[model samples]
Target: MTDSSAPPPAPAGPLSGLLVADFSRILAGPYATMLLADLGAEVVKVESPAGDDTRTWMPPVRDEVSTYYLGVNRNKRSVALDLKDAGDLAAARELARRADIMVENFKPGGLRRFGLDYESVSGSNPGIVYASISGFGSGGGASLPGYDLIVQAMSGLMSLTGEPDGPPYRAGISVFDVMTGLHAIIGVLAALHHRAETGRGQHVEVNLLSSALSGMVNHTSAFVAGGVVPMRMGNAHPSLFPYEPLPTADGDLIITAGNDGQFRALCEVLGVPELAGDPRFARTKDRTANREELRPLLVERLKQRPKMEWFHELVAAGVACGPINTVDEGVGFAEELGLDPVVTPGEGDRAVPSVRNPISLSLTPPSYRLPPPALGEHGAEIRAWLAEPTTD
Candidate 1:
């Protein structure tokens, strides 16, 4: 038997024997299942006949397929099942029965009528680790649709973003959705461990709003713990001075002097070492308190060199800094640092490029045995497996 404190090692990868019934759609649920699949779980993505909504999310397309869908659906098999149909409902229930874990993002109580909710499914599979993702909690915000932008606004992330005097702006990415998905992954993994120890699975619930609030970290703490509602500081950090992007002769550079030493080094690079000892800016806290008074002085010296030139100089001088990079340049920088940020999920010409799984397990690293599936690509096989006498 495996160690009681942890789930058994996967048959191939870290989670190889795990079977994930993914009855979720869009970003949050799909993203969570993809993480499990990367760890060697056999994830069957159960979708409506229309498929995932992201499959139709278009514009940035490759091979005529939605890159949005491709971005998170990798390493999983697709099995279309419409819950409204009796036969399909039976198939879905059977899939759930066989699943070691089940993930869903349906509205609160949405799956209860179909007998596919956690209560219903766990009736047959007592050891199933069931995870539910939602826009908000099931309590009062059940009806409110959970979208990243809405969460960003409601959870006060938008309030903390953008210019102090301008209207709040949404982040360039669906930050809350991704964060909630990651939280789901964490919950599922923990529940899996519990199941391994006691042979009893449990429900894991994560909401976008809650995740957003949690993701805000210091900002939220400022409001809740310190009785300070953090306002937008734009590119500047509210807690730290010299933490935002600074202009150079050619372009902008992101310079972060996080500590007194780094701040002193940054001053030295700007040929103003004496400024480090100045009473108004001698300490990190003092600098933050007097950043308005210090910004002009730093900007004047920063404009002497190009962004990249200053980046190298400051970095070498032990002050943390970098030039602002576009998405492609970011990837190139990762490559230059041997981070290997991208991976092709499978072999052959049809394999699509994807961001590599961030985890690095020495014993059982994540595998890329399969590319993302086409719509209903594994329907026949999955249905046949569900029809087996005892999938358990």
Candidate 2:
């Protein structure tokens, strides 16, 4: 639960006055719109009569609400519309036509028949920043659904996870979806900037496949430079050793000795100073070559101490080390470290807890001014705002 004593004062955030018509659903689109809302944009989440699929993705429900849906829909309003219904579709189109920015993750040509495609909407909303998120680019792979697991497999991300000798494993989180969302955010921002200069809008397209490839920066670099596809090395880095999780007496601790000096400090902290001077383990390259041999030595020595003990010792010795923590533990640890990562908005039956946006600007901090809405909760209010006569 989030702290609910008093609401934090709103910051002068970027996008403070922007209006976003969010026609996207599920993870990627909603996540991007959440970011916009965090920066103080008024996001209208346009959903179908059946609601977003995430609204039913449950197990951890609060007062019959899906926690999954609540997680990313914060600081926004919801308006239900059945696109097939003529009146509802017209309302949706009006919202998009008047919006400063419009985002959608519908399948390729899915909204075209309803006259909501970028080409159609931009015909009237010439200054709109239109953005689209998809599983793949609007080309050969556009017809396929954009599931995170499938993108992970198709983009070679699964190949670079897990143990080297084990079958490929998907990341526990929807990494591809998250990455695509971030990319969509970037595209929308860039388009907005471009519109400011040109006084005309353009279509911005982002897809899971491209995002996954971009997210694989370091791993892809290794393959492109060495002509060898990276194999899953589990927690071990391909180019560094003593950088993987080492077994401790109680649990596991990850050590990230990125440089020779850090490696030496780690060795001294582990009571194995001689290991740092050894010819086969002298430099980063040498450490990588002798990782298999060095791993066992570090593991054996680390096993003598508990994870917390080693973590403290390594930190004091200027070596990067952290205990492997679960999601709950990580959140708790952040709170202990004085990082307020959660926010509670308002006092109402529909109020929900939301995580603060990670990005921080000194003059423009992200906000949690509103809670996630109930389905069509703001339909009447938003339609009234839309129907009000515009001076322009």
Reference-based lDDT, each prediction: 0.90, 0.88
Best by TM-score: 1
* Model 1 agreement with the true structure over 147-206: per-residue lDDT tens digits: 899999999989888898999999999998999999999999999999889999999999
Q: What is the lDDT of candidate 2?
A: 0.88
Model 2 agreement with the true structure over 178-265: per-residue lDDT tens digits: 9999998998898888888999988999999999888999987777887878878878898888788788999888899899999999
Runs of candidate 2 exceeding 4 Å displacement: 1-12
How many Å off is the CA of 258 in candidate 2? 0.9
Alpha carbon deviation, residue 99, candidate 2 (Å) = 0.5
Off-target runs (Cα >4 Å) in candidate 1 are 1-11
Give the per-residue Cα lDDT of candidate 2 at 378.
Answer: 81
